[model samples]
Target: MPRILAIDYGQKRTGIAVTDEMQIIASGLTTVPTHTLIDFLKNYFEKEKVEAVLIGEPKQMNGQPSQSASIIKGFATHFSNIFPEMKVVRVDERFTSKMAFQTMIDSGLNKKQRQNKALIDEISATILLQDYLRQK
Candidate 1:
């Protein structure tokens, strides 16, 4: 069975998450540099069977596209072109960062660990995947 993948795209780093083969549970996979995202995905897809890719869509409080939205959209386009057979979808990610922070706190992460931006990105991706699952 193929799994669902999620991405939390950022300027410097990108977070990756994946659901179980049955698509029942979402888990953080890794965080990679933005410049290396495509290569990372290429290697990952070669090893894992992915049914779809879900990317977090950032938006402002007024529901307008956030500054980072354009960049993410560009990446999404490139991703589609690279993996024509893979399905890609965008999901609203309004407060995922805040939610990630709270999750880390609840998980008992130390202050330093909580401050790790990569960790935050991974958690945000996990949250995004979980949200997508709920919506489905």
Candidate 2:
């Protein structure tokens, strides 16, 4: 089976994660600049047998869409338009970033490491992928 890919979309940087061919074990792929995300995905799709993409959808405490939500939605639309063969799904990402930061702290990452927002983004992508897999 083709693998599943997940994206933690951010304004400046986008984190990427992927599942194995069997759709198990979501792992961090990389963090890339937001502007280059579409090109990056195009290249990655050419190289990998990707079936679908899961993007993180941000929401507020009252269940309203966050500021970043529109950007993510735009990206998701562009992604779908560009790669019509692949399916795109948006998963609610409420506390994945906070959870990733706390996980980094619990994993004994130093202060400097914890300060790396890209790392947290990547971890959040992983978390989002795991959540998608669980639902499946």
Candidate 3:
């Protein structure tokens, strides 16, 4: 079975996570610069069989799409055009960042370690993937 990939997209950086070939465990892959995300995904796809890519969809507490929705929409459109065979999924990502931060704290990470935005992004991506798996 091909694995599923998850993305936590940000303005400056994007976090990537992937499931095992069995699609059981979701693990953080890496964080790449936002500008380099497409290239990164292309390179990763060359080495791995990905069944789908989950893109985080940010929404407000009031059930409204967040401002970042436009950016994600544009990227998703371009991604589909580039890799028509790949499946694209949008998952609600409300409070993922806060949950990731709390996870870091619970893991006993130091303040400096907690300050790494890339790490937070990675954790967020992992959380997004795990949640998706649970729902599936």
Candidate 4:
């Protein structure tokens, strides 16, 4: 079966995650520059069978769309235009950064490593994918 992919989009960098071919387990794939995200996804889709793409939807504590939500929407629109056959879903992403930090601590990452924004983004993507899998 094809895998499900998740994206944690950011202004500077974007995190990517993917489920196993069996669609059982989700794992962090990589972090890429925001400018190159489309190219990265294009190459990835060409090499891998991705059934769907789940994007982290940033929301405020009160459930309103966050400032970055607009940016994400724009990206999603472009993504849909490029890959019309692929399914796209949005998953709420509140406190994902804090969760990612805690995950790093639990994983025994040092302060310096934990401070890496790219790593945090990757972890956030993983968390997003896991949550999506759970919902499924």
What is the lDDT of every predicted structure here? 0.95, 0.92, 0.94, 0.94
Q: Which ranges in model 4 have alpha carbons more than 4 Å from their true place?
A: none
TM-score sort, best first? 4, 3, 1, 2
lDDT of 4 at 110: 96
| lDDT (Cα, tens digit) per residue for candidate 2, span 1-136 | 9999999998899999999999988999999998998899989998999988998899998889999889889888888888888888889999999999998999999999999999999999999999899989
Residue 4 deviation, candidate 4, in Å? 0.3
lDDT of 3 by residue, 31-106 (tens): 9999999999999999999999999999999989999899988888988999899999999999999999999999
The CA lDDT at 119 in model 2 is 93
Per-residue lDDT for 118 in model 3? Answer: 100
Per-model root-mean-square deviation over C-alphas: 0.8, 0.9, 0.7, 0.6
Q: Least lDDT summed over 10 consecutive residues: which range in candidate 3? A: 71-80
Name model 3 segments beyond 4 Å from true: none
TM-score, structure 3 vs. true: 0.98
lDDT of 1: 0.95
Residues 1-136, candidate 4, lDDT per residue (tens digit)? 9999999999999999999999989999999999999999999999999999999899999999999999999989999999999999999999888999999999899999999999999999999999889889
- All candidates: TM-score: 0.97, 0.96, 0.98, 0.98
Better of 2 and 3 by lDDT: 3
Instruction: Predict model 2's lDDT versus the native.
Output: 0.92
Off by over 4 Å in 1: none
